[model samples]
Target: MNYVSKMLGAPDISVTLARAAARRVYGHSNRTNPRAVPTSHRYRVEEVPPALPRALFDTHFAPLTERLPSVTYEMQRYLRRAASLRLAELISGGTWRQCATALAIPENSARQTLNVLGRAFAPDSLWPIFENVVDHIAQELDESDARVDYVKRRRLMAQWHLPADHHYAMCQDLRKLRTLREQSNPSPIEVLVWSAVTEAEYLHSPILRALRLSAEGGGRSLTLSIHRLVRPTSPVGGSLRLRPTD
Candidate 1:
């Protein structure tokens, strides 16, 4: 009654014989049993395997689908920031002017605060791509007066020492100095000292006032200069000279 029984032309087919026949037909084995063959020589219908459950299907695919979009978005953002930094470095290093003429921007206009910022924050891991973005910003600034002027104004104000009323400006400049200090290759102390001086000049706060007071008080007076300390004279001709004890 079963497919295997019909194939063997027998009233019943042994499970072992059916399994062996299936294996041979599927190419797992080459040898066949001649005695097990049926004279009818016709194939019978085989039962289809049961389908996998929905829960198992979801378990296998859900995680991959959930993570794919997040991974793609992060990679795209990383690439963009990387490219921006690369272009910035090129412009900051003074190479942008040469290339700007072809792009119809004045050399002066090509320099912008954004390009400087890009160069300053160039991503260490993605330096090359970021440099390209800096270059693009430079090129764009070259062609547009509005962008160039805005960048120039920002840079000028960034470095300018506005009076203490502009506490915000001083804060911005100090923040930039701190950022630069972290990135500079020089000794950290030296960078810090420079930053302090820059901050003092820009902010004119109590710290700078104290520093000025200390410098002015360091023994410089409005009278004839007098040596406050004495040193023993070096021995000459084997005789040490002594000051007269008047």
Candidate 2:
């Protein structure tokens, strides 16, 4: 089972159908088998915070019986508060320091923070923390070039390798740049940051990489995971196994 499914107590999927479905849905990928299940109108259900609707399991019923027997930690570090707490507990020693490190919070506040997290009844408060934690993990992942906010023009210019005299030209071009930014529909800041941070080559910083992963499926992954954790057990079984593609 994948980390998301395992964490949610979702049953394993059928390998053949999962593979065929992924290929059909996403086209063939040489790197690995495609594994993301689509959230089409056929699978759509009314979703509220912290509940995995029965429709999800019912709709995807055909391919979830057999086990896929593997897990991924890359996305595990990016789970919701409760799942993250569960993960922290599962880590070696399960110390406050360990939990602190995992949650990207200060060691002193680790125990208190976890206590609060453990008892948090509402999902609203936890989401922001998840974003902040992921950014911290991204910063931690990249050890060599320290990550810092490049919000200022001087810093942005240095990052973008722009000549001092080009500031006015670039500012003027912002109007024309609107069309380019519209292609991806990225935020103004995102476009500005991307242009500055990634000069010629797309050398994404750790935070940007984390942001990209977090933005997958329009932030549906985290929401799904949250819903999964809220209702962790399911008796339903089916016949397909799925794994994430590169």
Candidate 3:
């Protein structure tokens, strides 16, 4: 969708104006601009609350399995893998990581393994669990580098004249989310967004990228879901998809 369309759907004029102001700064000459320029208005996903992994497994993944036998089997595989990983983490801190007493595995190796799992065996949904042993296995919740990186990105956005509130509003969500994995607790919203966006190669806006998630089935056409957060009041989502590849 076009920028005007994205603005038109904003909750209010203030948000729309904030978005506009930020866009203007990002629209500067790409060659001269050091910051990444969003080529489109990225989808904004809704926020989810934090919850335990077993609770998440039941709430998020268990239901889908009921609808199809194939789904059930696939989910079972993911659970077993999670159980094994959790055990490994508990017993030896996972295959890549060191024992609880020593330094952990290289971030590169851990990230590579996460990437392989995500693209292939990563379940369509996850069972969020907090056991102190495997909570960190998910990796999305322990994003110190990502968080710091976005801080710099947001600073550039503001330095070029973007509204502080607009950026802060986003940072608040990111801050809350990055910390969710310490307990292996995640809201359904978090699982959904993480499943869709973790391996995305490109996004229109780096800070705003989590708001947009890439959706598709294995061997299925892709779709882009854009949404607004329901805020402290509730999570009755308002959704739009742009040029869905149906």
Local distance difference test, each candidate: 0.29, 0.30, 0.29
Give model 2's TM-score versus the native structure: 0.20
Ranking of all predicted structures according to TM-score, beginning with the best and ending with the worst = 2, 1, 3
- Give me the overall lDDT of model 1: 0.29
lDDT of 3 at 189: 32
Top candidate (TM-score): 2
Q: What is candidate 2's lDDT per residue for 97-158, written digit by digit as tens?
A: 45444334344443443444323312333323432343343233234243332223223444
Q: Candidate 1: lDDT of 34? A: 12
Model 1 TM-score is 0.19
TM-score of each: 0.19, 0.20, 0.18
User: Which digits, one per residue and each the tens of the lDDT, describe model 3 over residues 90-175?
Assistant: 33322322211121123343334334333433233222222222333333334323222222333344223224454345346465
Q: In candidate 3, what residue range of length 10 has the lowest lDDT sum?
A: 43-52
Number of colliding residue pairs in model 2: 11
CA lDDT of 176 in candidate 2? 28
Clashes of 1: 15
